[model samples]
Target: MDMAETAAAVVDRQADERVRLVVTGMTCGSCSARVERALNRVDGVTATVNFATGIATVDAPRAVGPERLCGVVEDAGYEAAVQSGTAALDTGPEDRAAAALFRRLVVALVLFFPLADLSVMFATVPATRIPGWQAILLALALPIVVWSAAPLHRRALTGLRTGAMSMETLVSIGITAATAWSIVTLFARPAPVRGHGVWAAIMSADSIYLEVAGGVTVFVLAGRYFEAKAKRRAGGALRALAALGVRDVTVLTGDGREIAIPADELTVGRRFVVRPGARIATDGVVAQGFSSIDTAAMTGEATPVEAGPGAPVCGGTVSLTGRLVVTATAVGADTRLAGMIRLVEQAQEGKAGLQRLADRIAGVFVPAVLALAVLTAGGWLLAGGGTDRAFGAALAVLVIACPCALGLATPTALMVASGRGAQLGIFVKGQQALETSRTIDTVVFDKTGTVTLGEMTVSAVHTDLDRDEIVRLAGGLESASEHAVAAAVTAHARARHRELPPVTDFAALPGLGARGRVEDREVLIGSPALLDARRIAAPPGLRAALESEQRLGHTAVYLCLDDRAVAVLAVSDTVHPTAADAITRLHRLGLRTLLLTGDNTAAARAVAAEVGIDDVVAEVLPAGKVEVIRELQARGRRVAMVGDGINDGPALATADLGLAIGRGADVAIGAADIILVRDDLAAVPDAIGLAHATLRTIRGNMVWAFGYNVAALPIAVAGLLNPLLAGAAMAFSSFFVVWNSLRLREFRP
Candidate 1:
């Protein structure tokens, strides 16, 4: 093949195996489009842009790496960086730039205040029409426009060139139109004496009003900067999770030598050596080593985990002692650490109910504002108003109707509240949970470990045969199982130091129990249902013990021989230490709490009373929980399901808001919109408080942003206000909205 054909073939091969680089830097929609265009131009590349988060993920040839991509972005007069296969905290270099912009904006505003007063006086009084004063006013306005508003001008031009209409477009067009109209009239020669128009031939210092124009630009830009910064800060939790991946690893080669290599270069099935005091490079299993791994990063439990052969170890876990050869099971983004980071980022990015409402409103807000401006201008001209009056009316309509406030109210507060939540080990999915938590009137809690400690302690053991022998044999069979009840049984036997025989043909029956052949004798350990199916007869005394245990809300497991019940073992679950206090706190906050469980009614009711819960739904299957939540919702109450189990998944997803106890089952976490990482029931109340605070702040921002526009629009259009004063008011309005949203960052809960 020819060289060109060979090059094309190589490009196709690279494209087939390409992995996208998830990048961040774009600030506006135009930036998104620009990045997409530039990346698509590369020989073997494809890209997708998310304007909301300003992230662009590009799939490209390895030869056209991230450094080359960053160069392309810089060349286009913007910024870009390679994501280090890690989660990114929202606040970064962009926040610093915003701070600098804010400082410049504040300085510009201070300078414009005095100039605003002078311009108003000059417009009202016809006496200060001196040419020298007008020249000085115009000259002073020049620096402010070109210097203070330069960023907006440059951005606007870039956006227009890329065929995208940005917020800067509206601001630049309004200010430039106003300034050009004033400058033309100021230098215009005397036209005539009859029916003279205002600003027709009169050269007043108010004509250029450059301070007013530039001040508006500076303030709006400042607000935008701070708003973006707040969002970045709020979203940084996921970035911290992403940074846990090990940077380098010690690869054990076939030559029996070890060499340092990048973690990304290590593939599945690779043998890597993790020395004492070194972190593991990937998710792997110990093959020829033993050590205690510090898993505090993933599990949040400070105690180190003992790992010998066949024990699992994740990337970034520190090996406290002993050398180990590990076989890599997962590498790169497939590692458990990477998966956790992905889940956090995905959960944060996912929109909740309230944000969807705001976005729908915003979709039509811009077009309506443009139409209103057009109508206002047309109405003014029809009423015999001059071009200057018509232009002023149109500008007022555009400035007042801008969705600047509406667009910011929800996401800004969510970012702030979620950021604060992360600090306390609570992960709120997004604005949806924030809004849902505030509105939920009823909180539903799962019984196991959520409302009660899931620990199953052995309460009593009874037998028809020799109690010691029965107990020993039962414990030996149970020791092989991982179930909670099995652990309790095994502990009892271990304490007695009884040598229990082994079991063969071991089988686990879901929700019923386990069975096996012990010492060539068939032994069955299970619930009453399992014993009934096998036609085992329980002794009268053992039946009484089972009844007593059931009445007290304890689980009774039966140990049986070939056809007779040999022993009765009971296990009881206790209420959590903090559960009662958390329930009381929720009640004080005006929320009603309920308990739902798969346990029998007697057991559920007993636990509910102990926890001081007013409502109870007992004997619920996984599907039955959904019905219970729906019934509560139908009673005009918003329900929040708090659980941590696969059975809880249905109810959690069906509720208005699902709060998952982080220590619960994986499926529970997967279905939940809010995760309480600390697994403390008290965090439930804390999350609720954060939600209310965040929603309150969002409303405050909306009221301030929209309220300012409503109050300022009439004054500007009625000719009672000059552009300088109007601009200042507008600037303060934007700043007020942003500052109000920032208050959510301080939410205590």
Candidate 2:
């Protein structure tokens, strides 16, 4: 089989059993990759590691148990625990880890500063170097190295045991070597101060690298502390989403007695009561009462949606203004809120394309650096440089070459971007979507429920009779039908509070006009074709008016009395108020916009003209929609499909990027790479703009990370940098990458 087929087969085989693991001691992307590789090495297993959330999602055969998965991660030099219950979403352990790191950083900072000052004092004034100065320096460095750097050493040992190397390995090796050399020099005979030149000073065995050991430990600890805090902020959106679900609910029993219970305890077919300002406990249909629900948290729409009898209300939305009796249709993981949270979490856990490359490099990076350090020391000694000089240069080389920056470059930027996207009501499904969005040149929009409001309404009514009388007649005939256009007419009449006279001999015609005797008049209501088929000739002005409504994309239904055309009612799906502006914005971004719909050519063109879309592909079936996307791709156009129906599913999966509206079918939402929770077309442009910004940030971060290592490596090898300076530079490199990625949080479209 080909690569795609192979992948599909693998997905099919592994779809049955999946486990989520919360891993600890992952200092960089390399560590994450290592764990992933180890899990994948197990028979019939596949794993994806997310560095940002510290979560690993492993797909395995039924034979592989969760314990085996955890064992694989543990063997890969990390702590793994199967994520279960509410703990799966909890960040308590991470927060505690961060707290411990912060405390270590504080203690290291307090001790390292004095050690640095004393080292500088001793270097300048030999007289200030007391008889037991070496002993005092060792005393100061011991606590910082043993306590502040404990996590690094432990992780390094774990990596070594697994035959892996990481940033932690580099840090541990450098600090241990420096501290060991300092202790050795304290007891050994001091080299004679033969010359006052810089080379003579560099070769002095009397020099104690106590400050280098302490400073390096302190700097790395501080960097990790900040990194941990930034990662927490990046995951804040998913946590907030999880927090939105109501913990408790009031369910009405079949006998009408109300009992409060946990929201998770409410099952399908159960009835729940929601009062004003209270969140709906689960996804359900309103059984009784009326209220306007604020769905901003779930849908990102600012306007409150009116929910009356039989209207569907989802979980995590607040009932505004009135009480509601809701019959639960879905609860717990089955709710839309739960599905959204899962999508967001999965997105955050996925790695971008560039991140994989970084991980590959990082996987071998520390070992290569170790070899380079060894080679640098051996070369210096062979060139007649003393042992002290060679060892110091090697220590500097080990300390400066940090893979931490490269490992952080992509995931951190992606994390920030995903969180910001969620805040804007755009849920990016994964890193691939964020990367693909920047290259999208064409945006294909589905007409119904996408560009238009997807709701039918009466736009215009042309009738010689009284408008209210015409509406009453149309509503009276349509009240017996369940068609959308019929509902629109009936709803309009009801809104106007027009009373309908009882009709006798009401005869319904399938796809034809309905004829009934209303107050002794034969009333006919249906399409214009129904009038023509009945041999009823429309008046000259009546024909012209009906044609005008049809040309304007309205569904014109002719009303006749006693076999004569009396009125033309124009009903159409209303276009969203923001659709035109959103299309204009997409155009301004240099994207070609197209309307893809199953509507007739005239209707599609009319809607396209109003929205300023450049192209229209009308009268296409669901499969044909996928063909359109494929054709666009064949023309080298990277298309982004925006839709909200089950018919849009194949096209969504076929497009380079798919954005599904929140109110869309579950299948379409599942197929899409991005979800527009606001059901607004404006979010399309915003999502693309944010993607561009995020990609730019990732590129910037990569350049800095790579450039820092390249420039610093040569300087350290030339003996221009000592271990202390190298540690500072290494710390700065990682800090700079993370800080640059944090700038993404300030992004505005």
Candidate 3:
């Protein structure tokens, strides 16, 4: 099959069996990428690792199992466990880790302040140098270096065992070497004071770096604490959504007795009762009751929807003021709330293309920095610099070249953007959509439901018979049909209080219309094609009236009696108020707009003209829509398809970027890359605007992260920066990247 055909088939295929793992000890992007690569090496497996969320989504054959995946990650020197229930959204472990780091940071700061003051006293007034002050400094710095940095040491040893290098390895090497040197200096006799030249003074001064060892540990620990906190906040939206579901619910037993049970135990075909201000237990239909439902938590819509008997309600939505007796149709993972949570989790775990570049660089970053540190030490010794100078320069290089910022640059930005998008009622499936949306040059919109309100209503009528009789006869025949246009005619009759005659021998002619005996008169209601097929003759001016209605974008249905045209009913879908302005905004963004529909030429053009669309492609079948997307792609134009129907599914999956209206069919929503939660055309432009802004943020973060490393490395190698300053700069680099990404939270689209 061709590419378009293959994409269409992909949407229909069942998803591959997958396993989600919560991985620990992933300090940088390279660590996560390493786990991902190891899992992908297993037979029949594809793995994606998200560093920001620390989750791995692996798609593997059923034969592989979760144990094998966890084993592979463990072998790669990280910890992994299968995640279930609400464990994926829990941040308790991260919070506990942060709390532990905070305690260590406080201890380090308390001891280092006095130790630093004594070092200054010894340097400024030689007579005030207390005996064994160096020993006292070493005693004070020991716990901060050994105990406060225990986690770093463990991870660093794991990297060494696996023959890999990470940010932890760099930190561990710097701290161990600096502390070991300080201990040796305290026991050995002090070097003699020399000439006042800068190099001679640096060589003659005491070579103790006790403050460097203690300060580096504290700053690195603090950086990790804040990084963990920021990551939790970035994923807070999905966690909050998962928390909205009630654990226990009041279910009405088959015997009509109410009992409390776990929400997961509520199975399909069961009945449940919800009281005022209570959340609906699961996806179900209201059997009896009336209430205003608050769907804002589930759909991001502000207004409450009215729920009555036979109305469908979703899980996690609250009932405002009335009791409801609902029959459960879906429970457990089958509920709409569960599906939305799955989508959000998958989006968080997926990686952007730019992040792959960062991962590649990070994978080699530590090893390269190690090599640079060795060269700096060797070069200093060969140039006649003392061992003190050589060791200090090497320590500075090891402490300064951090890969954390590069690792965090892209994922943090994407995390913030996805969370912000969720709040704005736009669900971005993954980073690919965010990247593709920014470059789209053309947008093709499905006219019905996407641009116009999907609801059809009877707009006008022309007939020789009385209007009441025409509506009554048409409603009788249409009552047996389930088409939208038929429903519109029947609804109009009901609203007018016109009694529908009994419909006998009702037969639905598939694509044409419906025919039946209404009060002993043969009634036919459908398109003009049905009348033509039945050899019916229209009355004078009937053709002109039908043409006029069609010209105004209304569907004209002809009612025939005994093979004679009796009346023409015009049904039209209302255009959304923001449709024209949305088109204008897209034009302002320099994107070409087209209307694609299965409606007739005149009706399609009329709506297109009304909405300010630049082009119209009408009378196209569902399969043909895919070809249109392919043809546009062939012209080097990136296309984003906006649609909201089952027929729009294939095209949506085939387009470069697919945006489905929230009220669309499940199939369309499943195939789309982005979903506009509100059925408003204005969200189309708003989504695109948000995509552009998010991409810009990602690029800006990458530039800053790369620039910092490039500029700092040389200064450390030249011994212009001391180890303590280098450590501070390294920690600040990571914090700066995260703070830059948080700016996306203020995005207003």
Q: Which stretches of candidate 1 lie over 4 Å from their true place?
A: 1-52, 55-140, 154-166, 185-205, 249-260, 266-331, 348-402, 460-486, 492-547, 556-569, 634-637
Question: How do the predictions measure up, each by TM-score?
Answer: 0.70, 0.94, 0.90
Output the worst ten-in-a-row residue range by lDDT, candidate 3: 197-206
Q: What does candidate 1's lDDT look like per residue over 546-665, in tens digits? A: 988888788898888776787899887867888988999899999998999988988898888888999888987988999988988899999999999888998999999998987688
The parts of candidate 2 lying over 4 Å away from their true place are 1-15, 86-88, 191-206
- Tens-digit per-residue lDDT, 1-749, candidate 2: 99999999997776658788988888887888889899889988879987767889888887788888898888777889988854325878988999999999998999998987776556545667679888778778889999989999988988888898888888889889888887776678533333466545533422567788898998899888888887787777667777888878998877999999988788999888999999998899999999999988776678999999999998988999999999999988888888777777777677788888888888788888899999989988999877877888889889999788988899888878777777778888888999998899999999999999888999988887899888887777777767888889889887886576667788878887577887788889887678778888899898899899888878888889888888888888989888999999999999999999999988899999998999999999999999999998999999999999999999999999999988899899899999998867889899899899999999999899888889999888877787887888888888888888888878876
TM-score, cand. 2 vs. native: 0.94
TM-score, candidate 3, is: 0.90
Q: Which ten residues in a row have the lowest lDDT in candidate 2?
A: 198-207
Clashing residue pair totals per candidate (backbone < 3 A): 7, 0, 0
Task: Give the alpha carbon lDDT tens digit for every residue of 1-749 in model 3.
Answer: 99999987775443468788989889987787788888989988999988887889988877788998899999999999998776546777788878988898888888878766664455434566678777777778888899988999999999899877799999999999988887787677554344466554433343777778887998899899899888778777777778778889888876899999998788898889999999898999999999999988877677899999999999999999999999999998888778777766766777788899999888888999999999999999999887888888899899989789988999888888777777677788888998898789999999888888888999999987788888888888888889999999889988886477779999998888899999889998878788888888787688889889988888897888877887888999878888999999999999999999998888889899998999999999999899999999999999999999999999999999999998899999999999887657888998999899888988988888888889989988887777887899999989988988888878875
**Candidate achieving the largest TM-score:** 2
What C-alpha lDDT do the candidate models reach, one value each? 0.71, 0.85, 0.85
Local lDDT at 443 for model 2: 96
* lDDT-sorted candidate list, best first: 3, 2, 1
lDDT of 2 at 305: 92
Q: How much lDDT does candidate 3 score? A: 0.85
